[model samples]
Target: MEKLLVVEDDIGIQKQLKWTLDDYDVVFAGDKSSAISSLRRFTPKVVTLDLGLPPDAENASEGLATLQEILSLDPSCKVIVITGNEDNLNALEAIKLGAHDFYQKPINDEELTVIINRAFFVSSIETENAKREALECEDTPIIGTSPKIMRVKSMIDKVAPTELTTLLLGESGTGKDLIAREIHQKSRRNTKPFVAINCASIPENLLESELFGYEKGAFTGAQKTTPGKIECANGGTLFLDEIGDMPYPLQAKILRFLQDKVVERVGGRTQIPVDIKIVCATNQNLREMVLEKTFREDLFYRISEIVIDIPPLRERNEDVLILSRMLLNQCADMLSKKFTGFSDEAMAALMAHSWPGNIRELQNKIRSAAVMSDTKLISVMDLGLDDTHDELDFSLKVTREKAEKEAVSKALAYCDGNVSNTAKYLGITRPTLYHAS
Candidate 1:
């Protein structure tokens, strides 16, 4: 049973509440100091605070102070303020001061019970979501446990220590930049600079000078000589984002630099020697571009010494809830809101929607929902997503059976097909596991 703290001064009322809210392990406190002490010791998720306490029973001064202190100690604690029957103003004030809800002196047992249960439910959801977030590996840059993501991580671990020119292929917003940085961090040149340049974002005429620096008199705006991204990334990693968009003319120069490990400034004959690891990312199909004569075939081969393909968000179904919970927590902290988690409808909408924009789209939806939502739980409407999709099946029995089957299969695979170990891992009996399988 969950713990509940009752901060009533009257002995008769305290006994009555203890008997009424017998569903919880009730802790009693009559004054402000003892209330705070009990709060610290028991750490109850729900607290019933009475405004009529000693020293300031006439007004709501003492009780209001206690409410602020309780919230200060544990901001997530649901404080249900107990106000007088006629104390409408103090009740509103308590709510404004961050009390979860206000209750009248003549508290109906059933009504109070419902409120307490709701608070407990929200608290449990938040706690479990937080635990799920904590389960992610801190050392990894990527955040997913799906088979596709696990394979990507394993490939990264293997290739990060090598000097191969890696090419990452994926759709936009698939976190290609993150993978580049992870590879750089895990490489021998981690202590050196890691420079990035987007081929598509920069202008065509200036892209060459951006990759290979220009001399002081190279152009009208070139008043001073500057090192290009490649030179700056000496003994480090150079991340060429959207490499497929790099101009065909500039590809020859990049290939020359890669082959010779030397750079020549624009309009300068000096050969600048630089040792750098190259990591390129592109959302376009480079092979098709090469066949169409848009991207140079030789340059493609030079850059793609090793290729890593990132799976889109739509294909990573198992990671949707994990990423959503993590992103929601981030948005809540950034917006300073006390959001617990998504509602069942919102979760169904998240699973049903095809994330064309990938992780970036998911992030935007979560942040927008956090800003627009008025309650602790985010709804499908708050996410601005259609929940009535044909793909969504609201059958509880089917959903449970599917989830159980997947869990058992994965557990069995993890345990090397050992039925006893799989059952132990799933916290189910051997017979139950066999039936589920």
Candidate 2:
């Protein structure tokens, strides 16, 4: 049962209320101080304040102050003020001071009960709505139901629990960094820091000092000792983004650190030991770079202990609409706008366009459309996409071949690369399925 606080000075009225409000777990107080004490102790969601408390029974000053304090303590609390007959002015003042509602005395049990029930209902609705909003905001790190993305999630689940050096290989704007962070979040070191640094963004001259700490007076600007990214990420996960762009000279030191969990600071003699998990990401082909002598083969082998390949958004065709809707809703909430959905033309444009920039490009388009759209649904023109150029080819033979290929591919993924199971699922012979694939 929900708790209710009743503030009334008269003993006779209190007894009558206890009988009338037998449905609730009610607590009674006769003065402002007692009422506040009960409110703090019980933390009741609903309260009844008599606008004529002990010291100031003839006036509404004490009750009004109690009402303000109650509202201040819990802004979501429902405060129903009780006033004497012909006290409309004081009742209005109580309402202005943030009371939920007011009931004039001689108290009518039936009418007041209705008001109390309604306030409880409203409070419950608001509480549920707040919960739903929180859930929607923190849904998941990776969002998609496509087979390829599902495979990626499965890989992450398998690798996150161990202390494996993970390597994320993907195209530019394909969310390699997001995958890296997800791995760290699911790892044992989640409680510690998850430090990230972009190798390509930092210049060669400062990269060494940034990765390894410098002792005080080691260099002209190195007046005080400072820890590098690897040292700062001790007992945590260190994310090296764009590792393919790392300077060739520094590759030997990184390899040594990986082989032996220790780092020697620049111009320092001591080698500090560290316990950390390294997660590296790169858009370039490290194997090709190694063959060309641009990357160290031993370092590449050390980092790629566990490899996860992130597919481009265009490749995950089924996820385009899902990602677009989610991104649009997020943008709308941030911009404080009401957007229902996308127009038919806008959705077609989204699916048909080749997203060279992948998820990043899709997010930009949706955000732009949400800002420019005046109506509930965003149109193709608002997205600034040329639907004419993105029109699908409607040839019967070509469409049939494309559908058959997609069905086979999805079946293969769903069956975990089992040829017989995929053939059975597609209702085709094994040899036929093999030829189609």
Candidate closest to the true structure, highest TM-score: 2
The TM-score of candidate 2 is 0.62
lDDT of 1 by residue, 1-437 (tens): 46799998989888788878866668999999999999999999999999888889888999999999999999999999988898999999999999999889787888888888788778877876775565663687588877898788888999999999999999999999999999999999999999999999999998888888999999998999988888999999999999999888888889999999999988788999999999999999999999999999999999999999999999998789889988999887898889889998899889999999999999999999999999999999999998786566745347667877888889999999999999999876898788789
| Stretches > 4 Å off in candidate 1 | 1-134, 391-437
| Residue 309, candidate 1: alpha-carbon lDDT | 97
Per-residue lDDT of model 2, residues 338-373, tens digit only: 988998878888889889999999999999898889
**Model 1 clash pairs?**
none
Each prediction's TM-score against the native?
Answer: 0.61, 0.62
How many residue pairs clash in all the candidates, one count each? 0, 0
